[model samples]
Target: MRPTLTLIAASTLLLATACTTTPLPPQTIGQCNAEPASWAIGRAPDQNLIDDVLRDTGSRDVRVLEPGMAATMDYRADRVNIDVNDRGAITGIRCG
Candidate 1:
């Protein structure tokens, strides 16, 4: 009985853990006509040099999706595609 109870408890924990936030549905591709010469975002000046320019920009409320690229902040209904080049500098910005 004790072993059975332990097994049941473990099962319950597993069930609870399995319940997670569902993923968002797919969205249309965002527009990226040209690069943003110099747009004021919420990050510091040296942010681009340190890490992923998008991560530093702090542009949340994202509604669109950059399928291949990864996102770090909370996803929202207004995404801003922060495009960067090979050197980790912001090359473009598009809010959707």
Candidate 2:
């Protein structure tokens, strides 16, 4: 009888665990759409361009990455990353 109760408790616990829902990761929520802002590539990076990129890409924030600049590798779905060259021209745009 004791072994039967233990088996029932273990099965109940497993069932509860199986029914639990895991939250979506940050990268999966509010993802930035960079396609609209692809037109900004090859243009100069400026405050206006940054603002436009943010609006167009539906990103909550913007990060300008220049050559040799150190940046964190963290992935943010609501951010737009603008990569520029030494000539100060925008080279690439992406969402992480």
Best by lDDT: 2
Q: Write the per-residue lDDT of candidate 1 for residues 1-96, one digit (tens) a residue.
A: 999999999999999989977889886343222234135233332544323433334443322223357666653433555555555444545653
The whole-model C-alpha lDDT of candidate 1 against the native structure comes to 0.47
Q: Identify the runs in model 1 with alpha carbons over 4 angstroms from their true place.
A: 1-77
Runs off by more than 4 Å, candidate 2:
1-30
The 10-residue segment of model 1 with minimum total lDDT is 28-37
Once model 1 is optimally superposed onto the true structure by TM-score, how far is the C-alpha of residue 48 displaced, in angstroms?
Answer: 9.8
Give the best candidate by TM-score.
Answer: 2
Tell how far residue 73 is off in model 2, in angstroms: 0.5
TM-score of 1: 0.27
| Deviation of model 1 at 92, angstroms | 0.3
Looking at model 1, residue 48 earns an lDDT score of 41
The lDDT of model 2 is 0.92
- lDDT (10s digit) by residue, model 2, range 1-96: 999999999999999999999997655445699999999999999899999999999888899999999999999888999999999999999997
